[model samples]
Target: MLENPAPPPRTSPATLDPSAAGAGVPCRAHPERTRIGNRPARRRRAARIGVPTDSPELNWLRQSLRACDLLASVHSISPSDRALVAFAIEWAPYGGADTEDLFIKFGAQRNRFLHLLQAAMIPRPSDLGHLRNLKTTLCNDLLRAWNDTPPHNEKQCRRL
Candidate 1:
């Protein structure tokens, strides 16, 4: 009879480096994986998040609006408007929230949400620096997109 081979040395759990296991794959012990009887397991690719396509202005606006670090200048705005502004700021990078999100979050339809968001943007003080500019920029882009989305025809835009 053939002599049995010696087992591989055991490794302490604390010494396991997750990177060695592979990126996005969790580390786990599998000592018997070297046997010819057992087929090698396939490695899976790491999951990835997809970034959206956007214009330079939209990108700038997204980053700029989101970087607001002070709230002192926004006190003059009403409480509901403040919430709307905060929500807009939070979702700036995502090209504002979708209609479904608006309904779920604000309990309002698309048209009503846009109106409220426009109102909310009005009271933001000039002291907010880029944030004030962000209001005009964001509102214009959002409204433009809305207008361009017609029932079933080309958008008759005359921005020139």
Candidate 2:
């Protein structure tokens, strides 16, 4: 015999049925083990070497790809009429991942180049003026950095 018999646990109001309350009918007891009460733990794995998992810059690029009207317009056109159709028809021997993924892998400089390319490609009526200005400024800054790089001579390379 137990020293004291514990009272049964009270069911929450959420588990009670109002119709059965005054009808003298017993409701099924809520289960002792509840899946609803158990929350799965969140886990984040580390990125492998040279792999970018996610970052604000990557997120910004992804968002811009989703929002760009010029990209959407290009995708809606016939494949043969696409802006890069000439390159694909004549030079692309092997298929590969998209420009967005490539930009993510290459980092900011490639991202800026893509922005400049896209801004230049947007239809004249579309409002990409701000983006064009931004990319132009960025490209100018990038060119300034390249201005410091020593020029490579073809004769010097042939000697090596």
Best by lDDT: 1
**Which runs in model 2 stand beyond 4 Å of their true positions?**
1-54, 74-119, 126-160
lDDT of 1 by residue, 1-160 (tens): 9986998889966459755546665435764465222222321111133333355754564453443223324553456665765676566546567888988989997778767766654524443565555555555544544444422322211121
**lDDT score, residue 134, model 1?**
51
Q: Compared with the true structure, what per-residue lDDT tens digits does model 2 show for residues 131-158?
A: 4443333323322332333324312211
Clashes per candidate, residues 3 or more apart or on different chains: 0, 0
The residue-level lDDT of candidate 2 at 117 comes to 35
> Deviation in angstroms for 61 in model 2?
2.3
Native-referenced Cα lDDT, model 2: 0.37
User: Would you list the clashing residue pairs of candidate 1?
Assistant: none
TM-score of each: 0.39, 0.22
Worst 10 residues of 2 by lDDT: 37-46
Q: Rate the local accuracy (lDDT) of all candidates.
A: 0.53, 0.37
